[model samples]
Target: MAFDAVVTDLDGTVVRADGTVSAATLQAAHALSAAGVPLLAATARTPTGVAALTTLAPHLAFAVCCSGAVGWVPGAPEPAWCELLPRAEVADLVAFLTRELPTVALAAYDSRRWRMTATYQAMRPNTHKGPITVVEAAALPEAEACTLVLGHPDRTPEQLVAALIEGGFDPTRLGLHRAGRRFVEVTAAPIDKASGVLRALRVVGADPARTIAFGDMPIDTTMFAVVGRSVAMAGAPPEVLAAATDHTASVEDDGFARALTALL
Candidate 1:
Protein backbone atom coordinates (compact mmCIF):
# COMPACT_ATOMS: atom_id res chain seq x y z
CA MET A 1 0.00 0.00 0.00
CA ALA A 2 1.21 3.50 -0.78
CA PHE A 3 1.35 6.13 1.97
CA ASP A 4 1.53 9.93 1.74
CA ALA A 5 3.39 10.57 5.00
CA VAL A 6 5.03 8.83 7.95
CA VAL A 7 4.60 9.70 11.63
CA THR A 8 6.71 8.01 14.30
CA ASP A 9 7.50 8.14 17.97
CA LEU A 10 11.15 8.75 18.76
CA ASP A 11 12.46 6.96 21.85
CA GLY A 12 11.64 3.33 21.29
CA THR A 13 10.35 3.38 17.75
CA VAL A 14 13.29 4.72 15.77
CA VAL A 15 16.04 5.87 18.14
CA ARG A 16 18.37 3.22 19.52
CA ALA A 17 19.33 2.83 23.18
CA ASP A 18 22.45 4.90 22.59
CA GLY A 19 20.27 7.76 21.30
CA THR A 20 21.31 7.40 17.68
CA VAL A 21 19.70 6.28 14.43
CA SER A 22 21.10 3.34 12.57
CA ALA A 23 22.53 3.73 9.06
CA ALA A 24 19.77 1.52 7.65
CA THR A 25 17.14 3.67 9.32
CA LEU A 26 18.75 6.77 7.87
CA GLN A 27 18.74 5.22 4.40
CA ALA A 28 15.07 4.34 4.70
CA ALA A 29 14.21 7.85 5.86
CA HIS A 30 16.13 9.26 2.90
CA ALA A 31 14.20 6.91 0.66
CA LEU A 32 10.93 8.21 2.07
CA SER A 33 12.03 11.79 1.51
CA ALA A 34 13.15 11.08 -2.02
CA ALA A 35 9.80 9.49 -2.68
CA GLY A 36 8.08 12.66 -1.39
CA VAL A 37 6.80 10.96 1.74
CA PRO A 38 7.54 13.29 4.64
CA LEU A 39 8.58 11.59 7.86
CA LEU A 40 7.14 13.37 10.87
CA ALA A 41 7.58 12.69 14.57
CA ALA A 42 4.84 12.67 17.19
CA THR A 43 6.46 12.27 20.58
CA ALA A 44 6.37 13.24 24.27
CA ARG A 45 9.72 14.99 23.90
CA THR A 46 9.98 18.76 24.13
CA PRO A 47 11.34 20.99 21.33
CA THR A 48 14.80 20.69 22.87
CA GLY A 49 14.45 16.95 22.95
CA VAL A 50 13.29 16.94 19.35
CA ALA A 51 16.18 19.19 18.38
CA ALA A 52 18.55 16.79 20.06
CA LEU A 53 17.43 14.25 17.44
CA THR A 54 19.81 15.82 14.95
CA THR A 55 20.47 12.62 13.04
CA LEU A 56 16.77 12.15 12.24
CA ALA A 57 15.55 15.74 12.05
CA PRO A 58 16.89 16.32 8.54
CA HIS A 59 14.48 13.67 7.32
CA LEU A 60 11.49 14.98 9.30
CA ALA A 61 9.16 17.42 7.63
CA PHE A 62 7.60 18.34 10.93
CA ALA A 63 7.59 17.27 14.58
CA VAL A 64 4.77 17.20 17.08
CA CYS A 65 6.49 17.47 20.43
CA CYS A 66 5.51 17.37 24.10
CA SER A 67 3.09 14.56 23.36
CA GLY A 68 1.34 16.92 20.94
CA ALA A 69 1.23 20.04 23.06
CA VAL A 70 3.86 21.74 20.87
CA GLY A 71 4.49 21.63 17.14
CA TRP A 72 7.92 22.27 15.61
CA VAL A 73 9.55 22.54 12.24
CA PRO A 74 12.89 20.75 12.01
CA GLY A 75 15.17 23.80 12.47
CA ALA A 76 12.72 26.57 13.28
CA PRO A 77 13.51 28.98 16.06
CA GLU A 78 10.01 28.91 17.56
CA PRO A 79 7.35 26.24 17.85
CA ALA A 80 4.40 26.32 15.48
CA TRP A 81 2.12 26.28 18.51
CA CYS A 82 2.23 25.42 22.18
CA GLU A 83 -0.85 24.34 24.10
CA LEU A 84 -0.52 24.98 27.79
CA LEU A 85 -2.30 23.42 30.78
CA PRO A 86 -4.48 25.89 32.64
CA ARG A 87 -2.75 27.10 35.79
CA ALA A 88 -5.83 26.52 37.92
CA GLU A 89 -6.15 23.00 36.65
CA VAL A 90 -2.46 22.40 37.29
CA ALA A 91 -2.90 23.52 40.87
CA ASP A 92 -5.89 21.29 41.38
CA LEU A 93 -4.22 18.28 39.77
CA VAL A 94 -1.00 18.78 41.72
CA ALA A 95 -2.84 19.15 45.01
CA PHE A 96 -4.88 16.04 44.40
CA LEU A 97 -1.98 13.90 43.22
CA THR A 98 0.27 15.00 46.08
CA ARG A 99 -2.38 14.07 48.62
CA GLU A 100 -3.04 10.74 46.92
CA LEU A 101 0.59 9.84 46.30
CA PRO A 102 2.78 11.55 48.80
CA THR A 103 5.97 10.25 47.28
CA VAL A 104 5.16 11.52 43.80
CA ALA A 105 7.52 13.99 42.14
CA LEU A 106 6.31 16.80 39.91
CA ALA A 107 7.80 18.56 36.88
CA ALA A 108 6.24 21.03 34.48
CA TYR A 109 7.36 21.92 30.94
CA ASP A 110 6.32 25.42 29.88
CA SER A 111 7.15 24.97 26.21
CA ARG A 112 10.61 26.58 26.41
CA ARG A 113 11.69 25.69 29.93
CA TRP A 114 10.97 23.20 32.67
CA ARG A 115 9.89 24.03 36.18
CA MET A 116 10.24 21.08 38.51
CA THR A 117 10.37 20.37 42.20
CA ALA A 118 13.73 19.71 43.86
CA THR A 119 12.61 16.17 44.62
CA TYR A 120 12.05 15.50 40.93
CA GLN A 121 15.41 17.07 40.14
CA ALA A 122 17.09 14.66 42.52
CA MET A 123 15.15 11.76 41.02
CA ARG A 124 16.47 12.48 37.51
CA PRO A 125 19.57 10.55 36.53
CA ASN A 126 22.62 12.51 35.35
CA THR A 127 22.04 11.09 31.90
CA HIS A 128 18.56 12.65 31.73
CA LYS A 129 19.22 16.12 30.37
CA GLY A 130 16.95 19.08 29.63
CA PRO A 131 16.65 22.81 30.35
CA ILE A 132 15.38 22.64 33.91
CA THR A 133 14.65 25.10 36.68
CA VAL A 134 14.39 23.51 40.08
CA VAL A 135 11.60 25.12 42.06
CA GLU A 136 9.67 24.38 45.22
CA ALA A 137 6.79 21.91 44.89
CA ALA A 138 4.25 24.60 45.68
CA ALA A 139 5.65 26.78 42.89
CA LEU A 140 4.96 24.18 40.21
CA PRO A 141 1.32 25.12 39.60
CA GLU A 142 2.07 28.81 39.31
CA ALA A 143 3.20 28.46 35.69
CA GLU A 144 1.10 27.20 32.83
CA ALA A 145 2.75 24.13 31.36
CA CYS A 146 2.89 22.41 28.01
CA THR A 147 3.38 19.08 29.76
CA LEU A 148 3.39 18.15 33.42
CA VAL A 149 5.26 15.03 34.45
CA LEU A 150 4.35 13.09 37.58
CA GLY A 151 6.59 10.31 38.78
CA HIS A 152 6.91 8.02 41.77
CA PRO A 153 10.01 5.99 42.55
CA ASP A 154 8.11 2.78 43.13
CA ARG A 155 5.13 2.72 40.74
CA THR A 156 5.25 2.26 36.99
CA PRO A 157 3.58 4.90 34.84
CA GLU A 158 0.67 2.60 34.06
CA GLN A 159 0.21 1.86 37.72
CA LEU A 160 0.48 5.54 38.56
CA VAL A 161 -2.28 6.35 36.09
CA ALA A 162 -4.46 3.58 37.48
CA ALA A 163 -3.91 4.90 40.98
CA LEU A 164 -4.78 8.42 39.88
CA ILE A 165 -8.02 7.25 38.33
CA GLU A 166 -8.90 5.10 41.33
CA GLY A 167 -8.26 8.01 43.64
CA GLY A 168 -10.74 10.18 41.73
CA PHE A 169 -8.23 12.56 40.22
CA ASP A 170 -10.32 14.61 37.84
CA PRO A 171 -8.84 14.73 34.33
CA THR A 172 -11.31 17.23 32.98
CA ARG A 173 -9.81 19.61 30.42
CA LEU A 174 -6.54 17.71 30.68
CA GLY A 175 -4.84 14.91 28.81
CA LEU A 176 -3.26 12.36 31.15
CA HIS A 177 -1.07 9.68 29.53
CA ARG A 178 1.88 7.57 30.51
CA ALA A 179 5.43 8.31 29.29
CA GLY A 180 8.23 5.75 29.43
CA ARG A 181 7.92 3.47 32.47
CA ARG A 182 8.14 5.94 35.30
CA PHE A 183 6.11 9.05 34.49
CA VAL A 184 2.52 10.02 33.75
CA GLU A 185 2.39 13.08 31.51
CA VAL A 186 -0.38 15.66 31.57
CA THR A 187 -1.33 18.11 28.81
CA ALA A 188 -4.35 20.11 27.76
CA ALA A 189 -7.40 18.07 26.81
CA PRO A 190 -8.10 17.06 23.21
CA ILE A 191 -4.50 17.83 22.19
CA ASP A 192 -2.72 14.54 21.72
CA LYS A 193 -0.61 12.84 19.06
CA ALA A 194 -3.68 12.46 16.85
CA SER A 195 -4.31 16.18 16.97
CA GLY A 196 -0.61 16.86 16.38
CA VAL A 197 -0.44 14.48 13.44
CA LEU A 198 -3.49 16.08 11.87
CA ARG A 199 -1.88 19.48 12.28
CA ALA A 200 1.34 18.35 10.61
CA LEU A 201 -0.57 16.62 7.80
CA ARG A 202 -2.52 19.78 7.18
CA VAL A 203 0.71 21.66 6.50
CA VAL A 204 1.59 19.26 3.68
CA GLY A 205 -2.02 18.55 2.69
CA ALA A 206 -1.74 14.88 3.51
CA ASP A 207 -4.75 12.76 4.41
CA PRO A 208 -4.91 10.92 7.68
CA ALA A 209 -6.10 7.81 5.88
CA ARG A 210 -2.93 7.87 3.74
CA THR A 211 -0.56 8.48 6.65
CA ILE A 212 1.22 5.60 8.38
CA ALA A 213 2.29 5.85 12.04
CA PHE A 214 4.86 4.04 14.21
CA GLY A 215 4.99 3.99 17.98
CA ASP A 216 5.50 1.79 21.06
CA MET A 217 3.56 3.40 23.85
CA PRO A 218 -0.02 3.60 25.11
CA ILE A 219 -0.15 7.34 24.40
CA ASP A 220 0.51 6.44 20.77
CA THR A 221 -2.77 4.53 20.57
CA THR A 222 -4.57 7.77 19.72
CA MET A 223 -2.31 8.23 16.69
CA PHE A 224 -2.89 4.63 15.72
CA ALA A 225 -6.63 5.24 15.68
CA VAL A 226 -6.27 8.19 13.32
CA VAL A 227 -3.70 6.90 10.87
CA GLY A 228 -4.11 4.56 7.91
CA ARG A 229 -1.68 2.08 9.45
CA SER A 230 -0.19 1.88 12.92
CA VAL A 231 2.93 -0.27 13.32
CA ALA A 232 3.77 -1.17 16.88
CA MET A 233 7.30 -2.20 17.81
CA ALA A 234 7.77 -5.87 18.72
CA GLY A 235 9.05 -4.95 22.16
CA ALA A 236 6.00 -2.82 22.94
CA PRO A 237 3.71 -3.81 25.78
CA PRO A 238 0.89 -6.26 25.03
CA GLU A 239 -1.73 -3.53 25.15
CA VAL A 240 0.20 -1.29 22.76
CA LEU A 241 0.86 -4.13 20.37
CA ALA A 242 -2.81 -5.05 20.44
CA ALA A 243 -3.77 -1.50 19.50
CA ALA A 244 -1.63 -1.42 16.36
CA THR A 245 -2.68 -2.49 12.87
CA ASP A 246 0.78 -3.91 12.16
CA HIS A 247 3.92 -5.02 13.98
CA THR A 248 7.63 -4.66 13.30
CA ALA A 249 10.91 -5.84 14.78
CA SER A 250 12.29 -4.24 17.91
CA VAL A 251 14.23 -0.95 17.67
CA GLU A 252 17.42 -2.81 18.56
CA ASP A 253 17.10 -4.46 15.16
CA ASP A 254 16.18 -1.32 13.20
CA GLY A 255 12.48 -2.18 13.27
CA PHE A 256 11.40 1.18 11.90
CA ALA A 257 13.53 0.83 8.77
CA ARG A 258 12.28 -2.71 8.16
CA ALA A 259 8.65 -1.65 8.53
CA LEU A 260 9.07 1.36 6.25
CA THR A 261 10.72 -0.77 3.60
CA ALA A 262 7.84 -3.26 3.72
CA LEU A 263 5.05 -0.67 3.86
CA LEU A 264 6.30 1.66 1.16
Candidate 2:
Protein backbone atom coordinates (compact mmCIF):
# COMPACT_ATOMS: atom_id res chain seq x y z
CA MET A 1 0.00 0.00 0.00
CA ALA A 2 2.76 2.44 0.97
CA PHE A 3 0.69 5.38 2.16
CA ASP A 4 2.78 8.56 2.48
CA ALA A 5 0.90 9.92 5.44
CA VAL A 6 -1.75 8.72 7.90
CA VAL A 7 -4.43 10.88 9.47
CA THR A 8 -6.79 9.33 12.01
CA ASP A 9 -9.65 10.30 14.24
CA LEU A 10 -8.90 9.99 17.95
CA ASP A 11 -11.89 8.69 19.85
CA GLY A 12 -13.66 5.59 18.58
CA THR A 13 -10.83 4.96 16.16
CA VAL A 14 -7.35 4.87 17.71
CA VAL A 15 -8.32 5.93 21.22
CA ARG A 16 -10.73 3.81 23.28
CA ALA A 17 -13.75 4.94 25.31
CA ASP A 18 -11.70 5.02 28.50
CA GLY A 19 -9.02 7.18 26.79
CA THR A 20 -6.31 4.55 26.45
CA VAL A 21 -4.36 3.64 23.34
CA SER A 22 -3.81 -0.08 22.96
CA ALA A 23 -0.27 -1.48 22.95
CA ALA A 24 -0.80 -2.72 19.39
CA THR A 25 -1.75 0.77 18.28
CA LEU A 26 1.40 2.15 19.87
CA GLN A 27 3.47 -0.48 18.11
CA ALA A 28 1.81 0.36 14.81
CA ALA A 29 2.52 4.08 15.44
CA HIS A 30 6.17 3.25 16.00
CA ALA A 31 6.09 1.22 12.79
CA LEU A 32 4.69 4.22 10.91
CA SER A 33 7.42 6.43 12.33
CA ALA A 34 10.06 3.89 11.40
CA ALA A 35 8.65 3.85 7.85
CA GLY A 36 8.82 7.69 7.74
CA VAL A 37 5.08 8.19 7.47
CA PRO A 38 3.90 11.16 9.51
CA LEU A 39 0.86 10.42 11.66
CA LEU A 40 -1.67 13.23 12.08
CA ALA A 41 -4.94 13.55 13.97
CA ALA A 42 -8.13 15.31 12.99
CA THR A 43 -10.57 15.62 15.85
CA ALA A 44 -13.58 17.64 16.95
CA ARG A 45 -11.96 18.04 20.34
CA THR A 46 -10.50 21.23 21.74
CA PRO A 47 -6.71 21.31 22.22
CA THR A 48 -7.26 20.64 25.91
CA GLY A 49 -9.32 17.58 25.16
CA VAL A 50 -6.70 16.29 22.75
CA ALA A 51 -4.05 16.83 25.43
CA ALA A 52 -5.74 14.17 27.50
CA LEU A 53 -4.48 11.55 25.04
CA THR A 54 -0.97 11.73 26.53
CA THR A 55 -0.04 8.25 25.34
CA LEU A 56 -0.83 9.04 21.70
CA ALA A 57 0.83 12.47 21.74
CA PRO A 58 4.29 11.25 20.74
CA HIS A 59 2.87 9.55 17.64
CA LEU A 60 1.16 12.63 16.20
CA ALA A 61 3.00 15.15 14.08
CA PHE A 62 0.08 17.54 14.22
CA ALA A 63 -3.51 17.67 15.44
CA VAL A 64 -6.35 19.32 13.56
CA CYS A 65 -8.49 20.49 16.41
CA CYS A 66 -11.96 22.04 16.75
CA SER A 67 -13.16 20.24 13.66
CA GLY A 68 -10.66 22.12 11.49
CA ALA A 69 -11.07 25.58 12.92
CA VAL A 70 -7.76 25.22 14.74
CA GLY A 71 -4.44 23.39 14.20
CA TRP A 72 -1.91 22.54 16.88
CA VAL A 73 1.37 20.74 17.23
CA PRO A 74 1.03 18.17 20.05
CA GLY A 75 2.63 20.19 22.85
CA ALA A 76 2.60 23.65 21.31
CA PRO A 77 1.41 26.61 23.33
CA GLU A 78 -0.57 28.13 20.47
CA PRO A 79 -2.35 26.90 17.40
CA ALA A 80 -0.58 26.99 14.04
CA TRP A 81 -3.67 28.68 12.67
CA CYS A 82 -7.18 29.38 13.90
CA GLU A 83 -10.32 30.65 12.23
CA LEU A 84 -12.73 32.55 14.40
CA LEU A 85 -16.45 33.08 13.89
CA PRO A 86 -17.36 36.38 12.31
CA ARG A 87 -18.85 38.63 14.98
CA ALA A 88 -21.68 40.06 12.93
CA GLU A 89 -22.54 36.67 11.54
CA VAL A 90 -22.52 35.17 15.01
CA ALA A 91 -24.89 37.88 16.22
CA ASP A 92 -27.24 37.20 13.35
CA LEU A 93 -27.10 33.45 13.97
CA VAL A 94 -27.72 33.96 17.65
CA ALA A 95 -30.76 36.09 16.94
CA PHE A 96 -32.13 33.50 14.58
CA LEU A 97 -31.50 30.69 17.05
CA THR A 98 -33.21 32.62 19.79
CA ARG A 99 -36.37 32.77 17.76
CA GLU A 100 -36.18 29.25 16.36
CA LEU A 101 -34.80 27.40 19.38
CA PRO A 102 -35.82 29.22 22.49
CA THR A 103 -34.44 26.54 24.75
CA VAL A 104 -31.09 26.28 23.04
CA ALA A 105 -28.08 27.24 25.15
CA LEU A 106 -25.06 28.94 23.63
CA ALA A 107 -21.34 28.89 24.50
CA ALA A 108 -18.25 30.37 22.87
CA TYR A 109 -14.63 29.19 22.84
CA ASP A 110 -12.48 32.28 22.24
CA SER A 111 -9.24 30.30 21.82
CA ARG A 112 -8.54 31.25 25.40
CA ARG A 113 -11.47 30.52 27.69
CA TRP A 114 -15.09 29.50 27.38
CA ARG A 115 -17.89 31.98 27.96
CA MET A 116 -21.16 30.12 28.20
CA THR A 117 -24.71 30.85 29.17
CA ALA A 118 -25.79 29.72 32.62
CA THR A 119 -28.24 27.43 30.90
CA TYR A 120 -25.33 25.77 29.14
CA GLN A 121 -23.58 25.33 32.45
CA ALA A 122 -26.62 23.57 33.88
CA MET A 123 -26.96 21.29 30.88
CA ARG A 124 -23.28 20.34 30.44
CA PRO A 125 -22.30 20.54 34.11
CA ASN A 126 -18.62 20.17 35.01
CA THR A 127 -17.52 19.08 31.54
CA HIS A 128 -15.77 22.33 30.68
CA LYS A 129 -12.35 23.48 31.86
CA GLY A 130 -12.14 25.44 35.07
CA PRO A 131 -12.82 29.17 35.44
CA ILE A 132 -15.83 28.71 33.16
CA THR A 133 -17.54 32.04 32.87
CA VAL A 134 -21.33 31.95 33.05
CA VAL A 135 -22.75 34.75 30.98
CA GLU A 136 -26.08 35.91 29.60
CA ALA A 137 -27.29 34.42 26.34
CA ALA A 138 -27.27 37.81 24.65
CA ALA A 139 -23.61 38.28 25.54
CA LEU A 140 -22.49 35.00 24.02
CA PRO A 141 -22.73 36.23 20.44
CA GLU A 142 -20.37 39.07 21.22
CA ALA A 143 -17.63 36.78 22.51
CA GLU A 144 -14.70 36.23 20.15
CA ALA A 145 -14.40 32.56 19.41
CA CYS A 146 -13.18 29.92 17.02
CA THR A 147 -16.13 27.65 17.80
CA LEU A 148 -19.66 27.85 19.13
CA VAL A 149 -21.53 25.29 21.17
CA LEU A 150 -25.27 24.81 20.83
CA GLY A 151 -27.33 22.47 22.95
CA HIS A 152 -30.82 22.00 24.31
CA PRO A 153 -32.18 20.34 27.41
CA ASP A 154 -35.06 18.68 25.60
CA ARG A 155 -33.65 17.97 22.15
CA THR A 156 -30.87 15.65 21.06
CA PRO A 157 -28.04 17.15 19.01
CA GLU A 158 -29.46 15.57 15.84
CA GLN A 159 -32.89 16.97 16.58
CA LEU A 160 -31.43 20.40 17.25
CA VAL A 161 -29.63 20.39 13.90
CA ALA A 162 -32.78 19.23 12.16
CA ALA A 163 -34.84 21.92 13.79
CA LEU A 164 -32.32 24.56 12.75
CA ILE A 165 -32.33 23.38 9.14
CA GLU A 166 -36.11 23.12 9.01
CA GLY A 167 -36.30 26.65 10.38
CA GLY A 168 -34.12 27.94 7.51
CA PHE A 169 -30.89 28.33 9.42
CA ASP A 170 -28.17 28.63 6.77
CA PRO A 171 -25.42 26.17 7.64
CA THR A 172 -23.46 27.07 4.53
CA ARG A 173 -21.94 30.14 6.16
CA LEU A 174 -20.91 28.10 9.20
CA GLY A 175 -19.86 24.57 10.01
CA LEU A 176 -22.15 22.47 12.19
CA HIS A 177 -21.31 19.03 13.54
CA ARG A 178 -23.07 16.74 15.98
CA ALA A 179 -20.72 15.98 18.85
CA GLY A 180 -20.81 13.90 22.02
CA ARG A 181 -23.31 14.55 24.83
CA ARG A 182 -26.21 16.16 23.00
CA PHE A 183 -24.35 19.17 21.58
CA VAL A 184 -23.55 20.55 18.15
CA GLU A 185 -20.28 22.35 17.35
CA VAL A 186 -20.35 25.33 15.01
CA THR A 187 -17.23 26.77 13.45
CA ALA A 188 -16.50 29.32 10.74
CA ALA A 189 -17.70 28.46 7.28
CA PRO A 190 -15.71 25.99 5.14
CA ILE A 191 -13.73 24.73 8.12
CA ASP A 192 -13.63 20.94 8.32
CA LYS A 193 -11.27 18.03 8.85
CA ALA A 194 -10.27 17.97 5.17
CA SER A 195 -9.12 21.59 5.30
CA GLY A 196 -7.10 20.95 8.43
CA VAL A 197 -5.63 17.72 7.09
CA LEU A 198 -4.57 19.53 3.95
CA ARG A 199 -2.73 22.07 6.08
CA ALA A 200 -0.78 19.30 7.77
CA LEU A 201 -0.12 17.55 4.47
CA ARG A 202 1.32 20.70 2.97
CA VAL A 203 3.77 21.08 5.83
CA VAL A 204 4.78 17.42 5.73
CA GLY A 205 5.23 17.47 1.92
CA ALA A 206 3.00 14.45 1.52
CA ASP A 207 1.02 13.85 -1.63
CA PRO A 208 -2.67 14.14 -0.88
CA ALA A 209 -3.36 11.20 -3.15
CA ARG A 210 -1.02 9.00 -1.12
CA THR A 211 -2.50 9.91 2.25
CA ILE A 212 -4.62 7.33 4.07
CA ALA A 213 -7.15 8.11 6.78
CA PHE A 214 -8.77 6.06 9.56
CA GLY A 215 -12.01 6.97 11.26
CA ASP A 216 -15.29 5.71 12.73
CA MET A 217 -17.56 8.75 12.79
CA PRO A 218 -19.56 10.90 10.37
CA ILE A 219 -17.09 13.71 11.01
CA ASP A 220 -14.44 11.48 9.49
CA THR A 221 -16.47 11.16 6.28
CA THR A 222 -15.36 14.57 5.05
CA MET A 223 -11.72 13.55 5.50
CA PHE A 224 -12.55 10.25 3.78
CA ALA A 225 -13.68 11.98 0.61
CA VAL A 226 -10.39 13.85 0.27
CA VAL A 227 -7.79 11.29 1.22
CA GLY A 228 -6.43 8.57 -1.07
CA ARG A 229 -7.65 5.73 1.09
CA SER A 230 -10.12 5.67 3.96
CA VAL A 231 -10.49 2.82 6.47
CA ALA A 232 -13.68 2.66 8.48
CA MET A 233 -13.89 0.72 11.72
CA ALA A 234 -16.12 -2.35 11.51
CA GLY A 235 -18.74 -1.09 13.96
CA ALA A 236 -19.09 2.36 12.36
CA PRO A 237 -22.51 3.48 11.16
CA PRO A 238 -23.57 2.63 7.62
CA GLU A 239 -22.83 6.08 6.17
CA VAL A 240 -19.33 6.12 7.66
CA LEU A 241 -18.72 2.63 6.33
CA ALA A 242 -20.05 3.65 2.94
CA ALA A 243 -17.65 6.58 2.70
CA ALA A 244 -14.59 4.46 3.37
CA THR A 245 -12.48 2.55 0.85
CA ASP A 246 -11.65 -0.26 3.29
CA HIS A 247 -12.79 -1.72 6.59
CA THR A 248 -10.97 -2.83 9.73
CA ALA A 249 -11.83 -4.32 13.12
CA SER A 250 -13.23 -2.24 16.00
CA VAL A 251 -10.99 0.06 18.04
CA GLU A 252 -11.08 -2.37 20.95
CA ASP A 253 -9.75 -4.98 18.54
CA ASP A 254 -6.80 -2.78 17.50
CA GLY A 255 -8.34 -1.87 14.16
CA PHE A 256 -6.07 1.17 13.78
CA ALA A 257 -3.00 -1.03 14.22
CA ARG A 258 -4.37 -3.73 11.93
CA ALA A 259 -5.01 -1.26 9.12
CA LEU A 260 -1.64 0.48 9.46
CA THR A 261 0.12 -2.86 9.64
CA ALA A 262 -1.54 -4.02 6.45
CA LEU A 263 -0.74 -0.76 4.66
CA LEU A 264 2.90 -0.88 5.67
Query: Which stretches of candidate 2 lie above 4 Å from their native place?
Result: 125-131
Candidate 1, residues 1-264: lDDT per residue as tens digits? Answer: 399899999998898888888999989999998888888999988878877878888898999998899999988988999998888888888888787778789999887788887778778654244677888777888887888998998888878877777766656667888888778888888888989899989997889999999999888999999998899999898989999999999999999999987876
- Which numbered prediction scores highest in lDDT against the true structure? 1
Which residue pairs show collisions in model 1? none
Candidate 2 lDDT tens digits, 119-186: 88888776665347888778887788899889988888888888777766578887888766478988
lDDT of the candidates, in the order given: 0.86, 0.85
State each model's C-alpha RMSD to the native: 1.5, 2.0
Using TM-score as the measure, which candidate wins?
1
Per-model TM against the reference: 0.95, 0.91
Give the per-residue Cα lDDT of candidate 1 at 52.
82
Global local distance difference test of model 2: 0.85
**Candidate 1, overall lDDT?**
0.86
Worst 10 residues of 1 by lDDT: 122-131
